[model samples]
Target: MSRLLTAAAVAVTLLFSQNALAEKVSVEELQTGLDHPWAVAFLPDNQGMLITERSGSLRYWRQGKGLSQPIIGVPKVWAERQGGLLDVVLAPDFTQSRRVWLTWTEVDNNGRAGAVVGYGTLSDDNARLTRVKTVLRQQPALSSGANLGSRIAFDGDGFVWITFGDNFHAETAQDLSALTGKIVRLNADGSVPQDNPFVNKTGARPEIWALGVRNPQGIALNPWTQEIWESEHGPRGGDEVNIPRKGKNYGWPLATWGLDYSGEKVPGSKGGEVAGTEQPAFWWKVSPAISGMAFYNSARFPQWKNSLFIGALKEKNLIHLSVNGDRVTEKERLLSDRGERIRDVRMGPDGYLYVLTDERNGKLLKVGLAE
Candidate 1:
């Protein structure tokens, strides 16, 4: 009888321990009534913010003023199942140039669609875009509707890194000559950087930096290391967070730790032991559907200094990772009880973590350690 009681107690303790390890955090809503907010960028003066909706509109928000009417001048976009105005980033010289860069699904002739990046100058009221020009456009346009992974990051050296998915063509991920499934580097003016790895390679676009990615949705430059960190969705599991190095290949279709959604082996090599392909610094066996990422350098959350924050769409939480050099040693999940798909994460100018929820009527949330 005592032995039976002891065994039962042990089982209970194990269950409790598992629950404790995966504790769900309480989320306090900050603002509501957003319309599928996809991206958020701080204004030049740090006094306000510009947010992009998936339905092809930009909204402005000033402290205490709340969200303004959807700004005009946004280019027409094909807001299909997963495509729309995806990301918005300010130019490195936004104060002087007022130039903003955007990525969206552009509808072309014959009703075909492709992801495109463009730049435009903001009008005087900062409410409308003007002089828009395409900087980069996807090639060999896809026939199906899926996987338009697009994100933009600017390096301090005046270069832009744009990530593109394989457009549901897994084979394209292994092709170096293809721009899909690659991170491409370009000058601020949309020209291929002369120092890019493929500049001298025949039949390769000079902008190609690194290849073999599936869907890199989250991208940011680490302010301390200046290295670009990206998070991407996996087939069934194996969501990955990686620091992309120049010219290195990150195996996607060629290698993966995930299985297909149909419970079959993924169409790739099984593990990261393969040569010539970069391994992720960290990966989740149960995908979180990581969408946006930002490194915490704010004084408001001193306890979270130098950590990386990721918005998890599938898991509906904010994932915090501690980085030691290039290694991810610790991970914590926040706002798990909220049950809202977090689509975008950014550091506000006021030194707090700003999050955008993914829903028809989303909300702008501020995350800080409870005082």
Candidate 2:
């Protein structure tokens, strides 16, 4: 009877804990008129923020000034299906250089498409981007339009890290010569680092730091460890959280907890593990289609310190994971009541959490702990 009572108590505690976070959270609309906003990069010193729309527009927003007209001088993008202007992040020396980097799907004259990285100096008046230049482009543009995983980040050593999808071609993920389904490390100016993992390998792309990811849309440097973490979309299920390392292979079609969209097994998958592939730090049996992520290291939400916040596109919610070292101790899903596909989650410089909804008229929401 004592054992039964203890089990019952644990069940009740767990139930209340899950609901508590939801009830104690608040969402406020900062901008309600966005169109399919994909990412957010907060400006230094709270100057403002830059938001990217998948339909090839960049909007600037300030605290009391509201959203500005679309910034001019953005590159022409292939804004069809899953292709478009994607991520925008400030250069590490942004305060001094006023430079911002961006990623987008670039199309060739023959109609082939691939993701590219570029940067432009933000004009002093904030009216336009000037001096734009291309930095890197995925090699051998392809005909496919889906799964262009174009997220960008800067590591502590000032190296640029960009993620790419397999372009609906899973066979190329393990190919050393292919740039798809890979995490690439490059210098600020898009030059391949001499210390890159595959630099000396024969016939390999020297920019590749890690390989074998599928539709990875989330990338963030863990504040505590300074290590990069990624979230990826699997076929039917099997969404994963990974800490990508140099030369590591994150098994894709060859090992997954998911089946093909047609209810068949993935061609080479025996299970969720292959001898040469690294295991995911965590995985979901049912995919949530995660996107942008941010690590919360603020005091505004005392209960949320050391938590990792991720956007859930398929589930239309936000996920919070309490992380200690590299282990996840708790997981909670928030904003299910709103029924919006979350496209991005970011912690603001002012210690508040921001989220982007993916919709025809999407929204930029400011999230906080309920007072």
Candidate 3:
């Protein structure tokens, strides 16, 4: 009787938990009126936020007064599907240096659109960007705008890490000579890091840090381990979370668990178990079109203190994954009722999770943990 009673009690608890999860969670809108807002980062001094729109403008978001006029000085962008001003992040020393980094897409020397990374100083008045200079540009730019992987993160050494997409060119993901479908590491000044794996190689791009990625969108550092983690989109299924190692390749078109949009096999893709390629730390059998991401290491939400949060574009939801060291222990979906594409997920200094929705009338929302 005791064992049976215990099993019944466990079933009741699980049922209640499921009910609670299905309950609608409320979200507070901090700001709105954005046009396909892509990414957001908080100002270190708490002055406001830096937001990027795919149409090639950056805006400042003040807490009380709302979004300031579009800050000028952004470079020209392609402004087409899957292109334009993509990710924006402040320099780690922004409080003092006032420097910011951005990644976007533009026409390259080959007269084709390609990914680029640049930096500029945010003026004191928060009106415009200055001293802007591009440091990285995709060589032999491709004509497609369908897959421009763009995200920024800083590792423990304060070096900048930037991601690039496959540009719908599957072959580029495996070509060491091309900058596409790879991550690059650089100094704060946008120079290549001396320790870069390809610096001494004969023909590989010296800035390339890791290779063989598809449409990576998120990159963040694990506060405890200092290892970099990333998330990416897949065509049909097989979204991924990866801990990209230096000089290694996380297989993309060459190896994937996903099929093409038409349910056909990717031209050159192998199964996820292919040899000579690194596997994802975590991956989904169904495509969520994962976008921005952040690691939670704050006191504000104790229950979720060490989890990973990711925004999903195709599924229009927020994802929380409980991680233990290198393994994902559990998964929870949040804010799915809204059915809006979550473009970005960021943890503010105050411990709140901020999100950007991708829509013509997009929103900046503050998500709170339920008690």
Candidate 4:
């Protein structure tokens, strides 16, 4: 019996030691004094990056040159609670086209607000945006400032994808005609894709690719499979990671593992499962308030290859997820010592990880393997 106990202790000790080694990372502050930075997009050939701030400013940053003043010609945004400039991404053919896309909250004349996507050409000198035009806007806009999922991603086929939250109206998630709480697919020019699942369905918005999501804040294209992975916040608990498929329904208020903040069951949910709705690939029973996500496909950290890194807002940690095929397990939580609200995380072209902290004086951080 003593021999067995000794073996168990050794095994436990080895497990903990391995985890500690795996979590060792070096974080370096790249740029400081950003005002509530929301997202970051790398420029071609490492020329620079485009970053969006929640207060409606877009800044450029490059190594050694430091940060540039806000580029001119950015459209006026609502910039209200949980609103403002959100996501920025380069067009798939940006190198030749100099085209960029942006998403933000905009208000209508009646005080109703919704998320909108626009595109413009980044001037050769990177001084301002030119030839700017709005493309897509969410329908049935509401007054609520919560749950505006505005993440943008491009598929292998160069299709543009956008996520929309329910705007605090949970029931609208299941509504086919409403743009709220859904994923929409479109051509690079903002035209609806005819091959979309709902293009031929009556009373259904033709642009919708998937439905029934809460406040999805993270969306990324898997470097290996090219599949899009999304992460979203649940009401009180039930933060979820999902791979949204064409026309699939991800159970939101209709069926969730989360409860209302008031400790009551979600109003319409029967439970965490429903007959027609798809289950999340992974879920958190206690909400992490997840945000941006990225897949580590670089050799900069060989041990971290193929791992998925997600930012945690409420928990203030970087959640490392070990992914195999479609199955994922929580490998560890990192950067808890920093105690900042992680707004966005992305793998950089230099084979390192870049993180954005949401704060009055936000920071851009570069993370690499500890030597």
Candidate 5:
């Protein structure tokens, strides 16, 4: 018995030692002092980047130079808890059109606010946005404050996918008639695609591509598989990563692996196994508050090529997951407590992993393999 116990201790020690080694290659901070930065996108022609802050401002960054002054002409925003100016994406044909998309919280009738997606044209210098127009808006605005999980991704097909939260209305997730807690597909001009799953269905929101999500803050498209993936925050535990499919229900408030914040039983049970709802590709038992995700397609991180990198706001780290086709086989936690909240992760054009920190004074960090 003593021999067996000794062997077990040695095995545990080796496991911890391996994890520590993996954490060593992470990059230290390169720049700092950004103000509550949310989303980041690279310019197609140059090495500079455009970044958005939660306070309704946009800033520019060049390679050697630091952050530029807040770019003017951003639309006025309704900044509130979990709301305000959010994501930004460059058009695929940006060289010719100079178009960009933005998502934010907008105040509507009845003095309530909801999420909205819009488009704009970049100025001659690419430093300012002009001709802003609303492309999509959430319906039946909620009266109280809650989750607004807004993230956007542009598929190669020229269509855009937008993910919405339940707005604290858990029951709204299962309701296809509403736009809350759903993945919506839209054309470049913010119109619903004619081939959407529910375009012809009566009483359903024509923009809905999939339904039944909680607070899906992270959305990305896998360049290799052409698949759409999302990461969402669960009630207290059950943080989930899902590959959304059209017309399928995702089993939100009605079913979950997580419990309520008070530790009481959730409505539907441990997992979503109902007749029509789909299951998550991966789920974390202890909630990490996943905020951003990107698939590593760069050649610089050869070992991480085709793997998914996720930003964890609650844990303040980057969570790396290995993907075999559609399934997540393993996970590694990186940069734990080394920085503040990680808001976004992207594979840069320069063949390095770029990260945006979320805080009153955030940072733009670059990660690559160590020498």
Candidate 6:
């Protein structure tokens, strides 16, 4: 018995020790003093980056220079709990069009709030996002500010993909009439594309691409497959990564791997998969509060090539996933020692990974190979 116990103890110690050693990359603070920074997007032509703060300020950053002042021209945002300026991305044709896309919690009629998208030109001076216009807005805004899953990803087909939260309306996740809890697509000009699944369907939002989500905050396209991949927060656990499909339903409140905060099962949850709903490509037994994502497609990190990078708010670490086809072959937690709630992760043009830590005094960190 003593021999057996000694062997087991050694194995456990080795397991944790191995994990600690695996996080070998070094992190450098690139910029700081961002108030609850939400997301960051690289600008075209190597100009700089667009960083959005939850307080409705759009700041710019450039290497060797510093963080620029908050760019002007943004409208008011509902900057309460879990609501604010969310994701920001540049149009794929930004080099030619000079357009920047932004998503935020917009105050709507009756004091309700909802996820809304808009675009405007980044001024020549890099000081303003002018001519801003609303591109899309989820329907029937609600008074609740939680679960506003707002993230932006440009699909390979020249369509813009946006995730609308279940809006704390869990039941609406199963309702096609509601735009909340859905992945929606739209043209660059905010027009409904004719190819959308529900373009002419009755009682359905033409922009909806997929439905039945909780609060998806991380969104990215798989570079190898050009597939739309997303990450969402579960009820209390069961954070997930899914490939939102055309007109498909990703079972949410009706079928989940998580229980309610009250320690009770969510009504209609079938414990993960329901007969007619889609399953997550990956899910966590314990919620990591996944927020942002990026695919390591650069040669600068050979070991991380083609891997998916995720930011965790509750876990306070960067997750490294080795994705093979539809399955996540492995997952590694990185940078947990920094103890910052990661808000966003993006790949810089210079082959480095940039991260935004969510906080009143947020920071931008660059992750690269250790010297």
> What lDDT score belongs to each candidate, Candidate 1 first?
0.80, 0.85, 0.83, 0.88, 0.80, 0.84
Candidate 3, 1-371: lDDT as tens digits: 11011211111111113334332344677776688999998887687788898988898887666777779888888889989999999898888988989999987665578888898999998888999999888775884778888899988889999888888887898888998888888998888889999999988899999998988899999997899898988878988999989999899888898998899998888787788899898888899899999999999777676799999998898888888899874457887767899999999988888899999888888776544
lDDT by residue for model 1 (46-141), tens: 667888889888877765566667677778888987788989999999988999899998766766667889988987577788889998898755
**Against the true structure, what is each candidate's TM-score?**
0.91, 0.93, 0.92, 0.94, 0.91, 0.93
State each candidate's clash count: 0, 0, 0, 0, 0, 0
Single out the weakest 10-residue window by summed lDDT for candidate 4: 3-12
lDDT of 1 at 357: 96
Which pairs clash inside model 3?
none
**Candidate 5 lDDT over residue span 1-371, tens digit each:** 11011211111111112253353344645457676778989988666888888888887777556667777788888887778888998888888888888888887766677788898998867678888888888876662556788899999898899988998888888888887899999988788899999999999999999998988889999887898899999998988999999888888987788888889877655454665677899988898888889888877657776689889898888888888888895467776747578889888887777888888777777776664
- Which prediction has more favorable lDDT, 2 or 4? 4
Model 3: lDDT of residue 250: 91
**Tens digits of per-residue lDDT for model 2 on 208-323?**
99999988889999989999898889899988888999999998877788888888898778788898999988888888988898999988778888999889999988888889
lDDT of 3 at 294: 92
Order of candidate numbers by lDDT, starting with the best: 4, 2, 6, 3, 5, 1
- Using TM-score as the yardstick, the better of models 3 and 4 is 4
- Between the candidate structures 1 and 2, which one is better when assessed by lDDT? 2
In terms of lDDT, model 4 sits at 0.88
Q: C-alpha displacement of 326 in model 2, angstroms?
A: 1.7
**lDDT, residue 281, candidate 2:** 84
Give Cα distance to truth, residue 168, candidate 5, Å. Answer: 0.7
lDDT value for candidate 5? 0.80
